[model samples]
Target: MTEMSVQLEQIAVRAARGVGDALRAAFVQAQQPSHKRDHHDLVTEHDERTEQVLRAELLDAWPDSAVLGEEGGASGDGAVHWLVDPIDGTANFALGLPFFAVSIGAVANDQLVAGVVYDVMRDTAFSANLHGAYADGEPLRSTGPATDAQNMLITSYPGPGTLAAGRGVEEYTTLLREFGAVRRMGSTALALAYVAAGAGCAYAYGIHPWDVAAGALIVQQAGGRYLPLPDTGRPWEAPGYLAVNGDFDLPGSCLTDLLPRMLPRTATGTPLPGGGLRNRP
Candidate 1:
């Protein structure tokens, strides 16, 4: 790996780890979340506070960097752009569920070079660079069952955006019947991290850069497939994604027919009315 890639990965980890303690303390402490888009899309004070801290830390560590955060829009302008989701699963965190995480990714030269996804309550760090993906510093290999009939599928589909596009339910129904199992995990970042750790084939819809940038690098580094929906040649910027486990046969799976068809046209129409990624019209 280049020295820059390794350095960026360390910087991301430090910035994410720096905020773990504060997140743990406020995990289930009567957080009153307000609607961002709706009740389905929520944000807490902790989310803003954490993002501020992270953005500061990241920029301070690498002065030649910018940040595009979930809570805060693009700030600073440099070669290294940092994508951050201080609280990836805000709904889960506000509801006293232990599934939220901190996600940070470094994009330089329009390519993802380094990233980290920290599971706050669990204290596990999933990270990646040009070299490979790692969970708490151990190498990862995203192997799983080859076919959908025998493998698990994880997603947050049928979301407000998916439903708005009028395509998710029928496709979801097909997934429900074809996959061996299905899980609707609130955190897209963690779902991708899980896929990198050999958990299951997963998909996410209408995600911002902050949501999947880190997880994308981690999944791809772990010997998995990161398919950017709409396939605009820029996985980091694309709003939709699918992360399949290493051994999974994506072409043989049901997803090949459903999501790829729905995304290109649907993503442009997916609503992001309140407090979504800026300049996404």
Candidate 2:
């Protein structure tokens, strides 16, 4: 990590650890859950409190940076914006599950430069900046070559009906069957963090900017690659994303072929919007 990246990472790590600390304290006593407008979506008092802690810590550390969080809404207009999901898997957390996580990232000039994902239950923190990615302070990197069909694949289904919600489900289904095994962890940020730690080989989902901003930066720093998912003709928005280990070559991987079929396309074979895809929870 360069000097700047190290400094920025420290700021992000402190904020993330603070979120974890709050979660530990607030959740230990049990939580009162409330459903979001969406029936399947859930939140808790802890979520709001954790966001409050994170926002204050981040804002205090970098007052000029804007903050876009799931809880407190968006604030500021700095060149560098911080995107956070106070608890990425609130549904799981509310149900006494340990899959929930705190996700935070710094975006500057439309690029994600640093991020942190803290898993409260395990006290594990995943972080990254221009320097690289880490799991509990241990440097992380994607494992093996990307072509192995036996590689682990992580996806987020949210609810039962959403699996087929995107483009070319049939192709994705085929890919799933071919891979070693598939995991639907419900938490986009944590799933991506696992990928960054080499706990999984690949991960993809229809994710919002807040959900992925941090993890994506971690993946890149950990020697992985990600970009907007190809549009499937639904809408031209910040497309969902597909990511793979940095060592994985598209030429020999199934993803290279699958990407074209899944991306949104025009009647004349033109691609749709490649940026600004945000799915608000």
Candidate 3:
């Protein structure tokens, strides 16, 4: 890792640990919840507090790096940036479910170089940079393709109607039917981490930069592929995202074949592994 990447890694680790401590405190306190932008999307006191902790830690390490957080608005616009989801799966957390997480990703000049997705309930930290991805300190890699009978797909549920409301929903539904099994886990960061750890084969849905930033780095460093959502055409920010294991083949691979078949094909043509034609950062 470069010195910058190393320094960023330390920041991620510290933030993850701090956020985990915060979540534990919240769970113990049994805090009340509030709504954000809508009722289905929830937030908590801990979420805001955690973001404050992250903002301080992140900006201290990368003074010039832009920071865009779920709770707080964007700050700085340097070539390097920090994208954060202080509390992913807040609905689950508020309901006493255990799938919530804090996701943080670092992007340099539009390219993602590192990220960390910390599962507070489980205390499992998934992180990666240019060097490689690790899960709880052990080097991690993506799972190989499953046999036709074993394939599994994971999803996030804003609600039952959310998917059908989008043009991408039709494609998403078609894949849901084709896959051997489907699961709605309510947490995008954790869903991507499962893909990195080989617990699931692929994941696709609309997600914010904060939701996938850390998980994207984990997926890439784990030897997986992150195909950008075609609509936005940007890496650090996009309306939708897909992540799959690298061991899977391309062209006819589970992800490549499934994505275009479900969502409308991009006007620019299909999105490629690691976002083709679009330059990397």
Candidate 4:
């Protein structure tokens, strides 16, 4: 890893940790979440406040960088871009669930160089740089069962929009019948963090850049596979993704057969129309 990449990784980790206290205090408390695009999409004061905190920390650490946040839009214009998801899984967070996380990833000259996903409830940080990936400062390896039936898969597939699209239900059924077990924990960042930590594989559709930018880099750096479905110029910019452990057999897994049917294709690189719980983050 270059010295600059390592420095960026440290900055990302610290920036994510900076908001832990406020998030912990707000979690499970009575929060009046206002709708963003719809009832399924939610945002709270904490989300906005945390984004501000993260934006300040990141820009302060690297003054020549820009920030693209979920709550707040783009800020600054520099070679380095920071993708920030202040509070991933806001629904779970407001309801007292402990599956949310703070995710930040840095892109230098259009390439993802560093990322950090901090699990506030667990107090565990999953990070990665050009050098390698780490979990709580320890080296992380994305090793798991080799076969689909032997490994656990995490995904929030077949969300409201997907169902409305008329193909998600069948896809969801196939996953249930193929994988050993399937879980929907409502947090894409944490789900990908688990994949990086060797917990399992994760798949999702209809997500935004901030949703997978950090987790995707962490997973790949951990020696896992982070494949952006229907490449949209850049990996982090993809609308959907399928991440697996380092040892997963993608060609043999059912996912390979299902990808074409599940993800929408367009003549242009624009993302297909779909929506899900993870769409907010």
Candidate 5:
């Protein structure tokens, strides 16, 4: 990795850890979560606070950088673009479930250079840069069971949104029946982190850039496969993704059959125009 990429990785990790303590303290506290789009979508005071903290830390560390945060929207107008998901699994965090994370990914000139996914409950950080991927400072290797029948799969597919869109329910059902086991963890970042750590394969439909940007880089750097389904021109901007340990068999799995049906028709389905990267000023 170049020195600049390493520096970006360190910054991302530091920025994420800046608010870890507060999130830990608030994890179990009673929270009144307001709906974002519907009952299935939720946001809390902690989410907003955490995003604010992350935004301040990132911009302070690298003044010439922009942040695209899930809760706070876009800020700054610099060369490096940071995608932030302060509290990925708000419902899980609010309900006392220990399965959420702080995800931050840095894009320099349209290329993902660094990423960090901090698992607040476990106090473990998964990070990646141009150099490589690591979990708690240990190099990660995405090795796992080779077959769908032998591997575990984590996904939150066919949620209310997917069902409402009238897509992928039957395919998801087939996956549940075929895979060794399937789990819905709610946190997209953690799911990809786990895959990087050689835990299991993960697939998701209808995800945002903030949700998978960091995790996607981590997966690739760890020697795993992270594909934005339907091959949107920019991988991070895709509406859905399929990620797996390096050994998982994509062609043999049920996912191969489901891919065509899962992806949206257009190449730029979600329309993140001019959002890939920026020129350094």
Candidate 6:
């Protein structure tokens, strides 16, 4: 399993970087992206093309593997299942923001064994296998201040889906007050990667399997906490995620109040002391 995971990790890294040149070239030009769910959700030609490129590479590299990609959908039925989001921040990329990424993860035995989150613009890869997490091969650890007031929290919560569910500015405002600062950078994969690379808290609701699979593994491998919201047995089976810096000291944050209301299931686990919960699940 260890050797297989290492091989998969390498395959993910190579596949993610292989399409970089084309993506970078496309990034410079002004291109329009069609909307997916709404104006807030976008899908560009590059996104589709990149996913195709990644899918072909992954399947070719591991013939006995299946791929669940955001753009192209699922293919094959092997033991090692791959989750991929070719362009994680498509809206950001379309709008000329340098925050998108190529994310891929390998799941075997009902567990994440390998993963990679490639920051395309920066050409950086945060990878993890059974051994540990690394940023371009260096050991990486996700740690930050213990108190909310001492660190910066990054989130894209209250997205269109969340807003429709009644989690709007109030929850956002509350998190801002409790945390030293709150930022909405708009990329779940990269945001999770950032958290694993020693950034602050990151959470999201209404995410697909491809969106959080790789980043979740990266966070956990880098010594951070990647909690599937509502405590689903499998993180990808659920629609939400709550990721905290490795040394953030506690299990919950100011965002705790929003989770229960955001998802269909009630949140259950250890109680959150500092996390003010108005809508306790």
Best by TM-score: 4
Per-residue accuracy of model 3 over 1-281 as CA lDDT, tens digit each: 35577567668877877768758768766758998778888888888888888888888777777789998889876777888998889898888888888898888756777888898988988988778888887899997664423566776533445445555555556656666777888888998888899765555555688988888778878987676665354554765666667665444434555554454334336554454324422
Error of 6 at 194 (Å): 0.6
User: What are the Cα lDDT values of the candidates?
Assistant: 0.86, 0.70, 0.74, 0.86, 0.85, 0.84
Model 3 bad stretches (over 4 Å): 76-79, 157-177, 231-233, 249-258, 264-281
- State how far residue 111 of model 1 sits from its true place (Å): 0.6
lDDT of 2 by residue, 27-81 (tens): 6566679988776788888888888888888888887778888878998767768
**Candidate 1: which stretches are off by over 4 Å?**
161-167, 264-281
Q: Whole-model lDDT for model 2 versus the true structure?
A: 0.70
The C-alpha local distance difference test score for the whole of candidate 1 amounts to 0.86
TM-score of candidate 5 to 2 decimals:
0.91
State the lDDT at 59 in candidate 3. Answer: 82
RMSD of 1: 6.2
**Which pairs of residues collide in model 2?**
1-131, 229-240, 230-263, 230-264, 231-263, 231-264, 232-264, 233-264, 238-276, 238-277
Q: Which residue pairs of candidate 3 clash? A: 171-262
Q: TM-scores for all candidates?
A: 0.90, 0.82, 0.84, 0.92, 0.91, 0.90
Model 6 agreement with the true structure over 1-281: per-residue lDDT tens digits: 99999999999999999999999999999988998878888999999998888888998999999999998889988999999999999998999999999999899999899999999999999999988999999998997887778878777766665567665667677777888888989798999999999888887767898888888888998999888764556876566777888888453555555555544334445332224443434
Give the number of colliding residue pairs in candidate 3: 1
lDDT (C-alpha) at residue 229 in model 1: 62
Off by over 4 Å in 2: 28-30, 157-169, 201-205, 230-237, 260-281
lDDT value for model 6? 0.84
Candidate 1 residue lDDT tens string, 64-180: 889999888999989999999999999999998899899999998888999999999999999999999999999989988899888889887777765776767888889999999
Clashing residue pairs, backbone N/CA/C < 3 A, model 5: none
lDDT of 4 by residue, 132-164 (tens): 999989999999888879988898877776677
